[model samples]
Target: MKGQENKEEKMECKKEENLVSCLCTYYSCSRKGVCCDCIRYHLKSRQLPGCCFSRDAEATYDRSFEHFARLVQEGKV
Candidate 1:
């Protein structure tokens, strides 16, 4: 129980830290600071999270794998 409590506390701390650096432009996102949840949600839609894209690309809101590949091929990533 103690270990579980510590783990939960650590996760909360990590979420706070992640929030500070989260580059997702969607301000109302519930999973903004929760990377795992964000990834899962995006994956379900056959897309990647905003954090996976460059600032400009992320702003476009096109988190498709193809878009990321194009950016990578163009040396923009």
Candidate 2:
């Protein structure tokens, strides 16, 4: 029972921990701390998550694959 409780506690802590490091500037995003949901939603729209880009790049809100490619070419990513 103690081990099971610890497992559940860790699961809840994971999301809280993720929220701390999440670089997404979209303050109202529902998927902000949920990596799986965020990845799925962005991929469906042919874009990557904000975490994939640098702080300056992420602030631009251009999450498109093409934008990422350009950043890579420019050695920004």
Candidate 3:
């Protein structure tokens, strides 16, 4: 029981660390590290969050879900 709880806590901590690592940092947006906040910030402007794109696409600042979808459809993702 306690062992399982410890393992679960460890997993949760790792997940948080991974989220921090996945932050979209190429832009000056205030929603850099928080995924939900980032998504909301972009969606408010009719844009997609950076995690929706490939590294190349994200670097280009093309935060459009349509563009990301196109990339995936075209096998570029």
lDDT of 1 by residue, 3-73 (tens): 45534333443788888878799999999989989999999998999988878899999999999899999
Per-residue lDDT tens digits of candidate 3, residues 1-77?
A: 55455343322234355465673756555556666677678898888877777677888878777887789899987
- Over 1-77, each residue of candidate 2 has an lDDT whose tens digit, in order, gives 55455343333436687888898999999998898889999999999999999989999999999999999999999
Candidate 3 overall Cα lDDT vs. reference?
0.70
Off by over 4 Å in 1: 1-13
- Output the worst ten-in-a-row residue range by lDDT, candidate 3: 6-15
Which residue runs of candidate 3 sit more than 4 Å off their true CA positions?
A: 1-20
Q: What does candidate 3 score on TM?
A: 0.62
The Cα error of candidate 2 at residue 7, in Å, is 17
Error at 40, model 3, angstroms: 0.5
Say which candidate scores most in lDDT: 2
